[model samples]
Target: MCGTHGDHGRTVPPAGEGLRIVVVGKGGVGKSTLSALLARQLSRRGLGVVAVDADEQRNLAATLGVDLATVESIVPVSEDADYVEEKTGARPGGGASGMLRLNPDTSDLVDRLSVPAPDGVRLVVMGGVLRSGGGCLCPETALIAAAVAGMRLHDDDVVVMDTHAGVEHFGRALARGFDTAIVVVEPTFNAVQVGVESARMAAELGIDTLHLAINRSRSAADVERVLAYVDRLGGFQFCSTTVLPFDEVVLTCEPEVGTLMDGSPLADATVGLADGVLAGNRRPAGSVT
Candidate 1:
């Protein structure tokens, strides 16, 4: 579907238009905030958004304006023993040595599992992986991974996945088939380091289109510091870089992104970021020097 900005503002492609994005970054760098902003902004533009919380923290739903009661009541796919067993032929917590279907049929899980959230977005929570006796949570991982893979079947839905803080999710191949990856970072060394690593992994996963968001940036110097760090870390190319200013309200607003006004600096910047993603600009990943 063609998107156009008419009198009613920007109109986006309907559900099933198939734009998949994964937002990754270090912990406490506003990854969930960016994900929530993008999901709400895109949904406002007239598309069906499936916001997936692949993080153990499951902060996306709350940030996206889902009520606290609902957020607490919802169970992540990894923690749903019955659903996991039905889909993958193995139950989690059943000892890490059992056989599980590595490639389960999860093409319909997205539709069957997602719950409704505000702004016309559907929320899918994939709980954290559990550690047991040095064994892998292959069943839980496979279930979540396959469910993400299943999103490909929906020709009209746009997916915005909020991954856990760090690069471990990329190791699970959960980022496969995503068209873009947004690596959010603060102006700190540790955050930039994780952002660079994530960008590298996304590129290696064949997600060529990448964007960088410097959250809670205090000034141009903060932006420059992040860019400098990226250059120092061997230069990962991001087609666009957005700086989300440090907002006192955002810091105190808890997790609900809906509290930000339309003209808020942070919210406005996220709108631009969302527009950039929909524009689908392509440039080879190179040094951001």
Candidate 2:
């Protein structure tokens, strides 16, 4: 199935479209917000969308309007001591600083553990690894890395990962499978710097699809200002750029209050973004296999 996008908008996203979309940037740059919005758009379009809350804060659940009880029930697969041990044959040692099985079977883990979400979305909370080293080779990290690198999704399914602040998480193989990456940024020097670094690193990782979305832009001028900043950051192929105006209504976001729904402005904007995202997607769904 080609990702049909005519006047009627996107049809079912192609099955096995190898799309692992990671949303990242500096802290407070709206990574979770963008991930949630993208997931909302994909789900609204009647496509299979998996929203992965990889960030330590676990913020995507709330943004995607998941109930508090469901959100609270999610625990990162890496944190499940018994499961981790069973799969990797390595017991937890305070942090993720133990032996590991490099190629653990993760085929059934995601489906079995993912939290059922609103619409057709599913949520996976891949919590952080408390490794003692900068780049620790531990069981938990290995499991996540193995799961991301080996797992396959249904055709047309899109994986939207909400990453921890900054590009530190990018070093892990779990995030490298993402063919498309969206780096959220605000109109600030620090945010733009992070965006540049994020884009640069993604390019280095051989990820061809890199987009920069400016969050909280007040107007078109502000968007331009952010664009100028990206240009100044000096060299990288940015596939697309979008500006999401600040919505005062979203300031009161609560787990129970709901977001990215029909009445929400954020949802409307993300709908447009979803079109562009699928358009830039060059690979087929589930092509990773």
Candidate 3:
């Protein structure tokens, strides 16, 4: 069942077709893992899924059961200098010194840049943000934001974006237009703090539906500790919460979500989370707005 409170009376629309989600969190909190699993789960239900890897780690393709050779060959939008210039009219190396298109037409980016994955899911990689001392990556960022905003989805399509770790992506508003954000965290102080910050930022971006995904929970006590920390932080609210158990199979597997057996703990919990995401009654909470 969804860990949702019914105190808030008004309900947001259920996540039927065209549901968009962004999975975010601190490093090593399993954001990519959750995103891949959720996409596959929805795909299994006969929904068209587009998995976006906006993370610097570049792990979504492999996690979605894409072959290693294709994963390695992917050229992220941020790193593809030629494509960047063609779309944005400014080279990434040129930085902000030259004039660039603030809003480029990225209508075909999703279809043109995406690679096919298992179960008919398409994968798009946004590449990494600029490194330290590198001049501004404004054009690159704009391209990504525009591309996300322009992705054409059919009635049965869903987008699952795996964002980079930490709060930097929020500053750029790369996740703008996403309907829901699933903040993943482990039962640790720093991780919980990051989750709180991420949740706050997601609300700021106008993403109203939020879910807290507690990964690698050893016991009920661990899950409770995380909830207590979120209460203490006190600025955001989660419409639903999911607790994924600590399973060694997650570690032994080849980092592929499909490799996890059907009845396994993580896989089962992820399917349940997908169900909650699709049908849960989402009510606006006092704190998040």
What's the number of clashes in each of the models?
A: 6, 13, 0
Model 2: which ten-residue window has the lowest total lDDT?
Answer: 1-10
Model 1: worst 10 consecutive residues (lDDT sum)? 1-10
Cα TM-score per model: 0.87, 0.86, 0.87
Stretches off by above 4 angstroms in model 3 are 1-17, 130-137, 283-289
TM-score, prediction 2? 0.86
C-alpha local distance difference test of each model: 0.77, 0.70, 0.76
List where candidate 2 sits over 4 angstroms from the true fold. Answer: 1-17, 94-99, 130-134, 255-257, 281-289
> Across residues 178-219, which tens digit of lDDT does each residue of candidate 2 receive?
767887888887898998898777766766566667788777
Write one digit per residue (lDDT tens) for candidate 1, span 1-289.
0011111121333345477789989998998888998898888887778899988878888999999999889989988899899987888766447777867888777678787888899888988872211135567877776788766534556889998878877764586667678889999989999999988877777766778888999987888888889889987767767778888888778779887847788998888787667765333333221
Candidate number with the higher lDDT (2 or 3) = 3
CA lDDT for candidate 1: 0.77
Each model's Cα RMSD: 5.7, 6.1, 4.5
Model 1 segments more than 4 A misplaced: 1-17, 95-98, 130-137, 152-155, 283-289
The CA lDDT at 168 in model 1 is: 78
